[model samples]
Target: MIASFPYLIVGLLFLFGLYAVVFERNLIKIAIGISVIEAATNMFLIVLGYRTGGRIPVFTLAGESKVLVLPTPQALTLTAIVIGMATTALMLSLIMVLYRHYGTLDVREIRRLRG
Candidate 1:
């Protein structure tokens, strides 16, 4: 049960974010939801790469044990973080522009303005 704690947390985070994105009316709340979803994804990646009693994959500090945490997932997570930040920034900027044009951040209002 304890071993699945991280997975459980990830699931909950994802669900909450999804709910916020789907139901929230404020643009900022939707942006936050997207960020939360990204965070959950990053957490899931880290959890997948975790290894008990694992050491860094360094050659100079050679140890008797050969178990090392997988680096691919970590690398992917880092890349995802960078990309997520850029995407979030762009999203927020677009929201700002829309707010300026429509004078509102509500999606329904924006849709109504479009017509």
Candidate 2:
């Protein structure tokens, strides 16, 4: 039960983000929710690669031995982190542009004012 705590937390984070994305009226809050979801996903990937008492996936001089944790998830998490960062930056920039044009960060206001 204790071992699954991280997974549970990640799930909660995802749900919270989803809720914010669905119900929030503020554009900034929606962007933040997207970031939260991305974080939860990255954490899930890292957790998936975790192994108890497992060694690094590296070849040793002696010989191949012992359990090695799968590196794929870690690699994927890293890549996702990079992509998420870029995506978040782009989202925020677009939000800024929207605010400048609409003079507000409320989704409804932006939609109503859209040309």
lDDT of 2: 0.91
What's each prediction's clash count? 0, 0
Q: Which candidate is the best by lDDT?
A: 1
lDDT of 1 by residue, 1-115 (tens): 9999999999999999999999999999999999999999999999999998887665547576567888888999999999999999999999999999999999999988897
lDDT of 2 by residue, 1-115 (tens): 9899999999999999999999999988999999999999999998999888777777554246677788999999999999999999999999999888889999888888876
* lDDT values, one for every candidate: 0.94, 0.91
Model 2 Cα displacement at 48 (Å)?
0.9
Model 1 RMSD, rounded to 1 decimal: 1.3
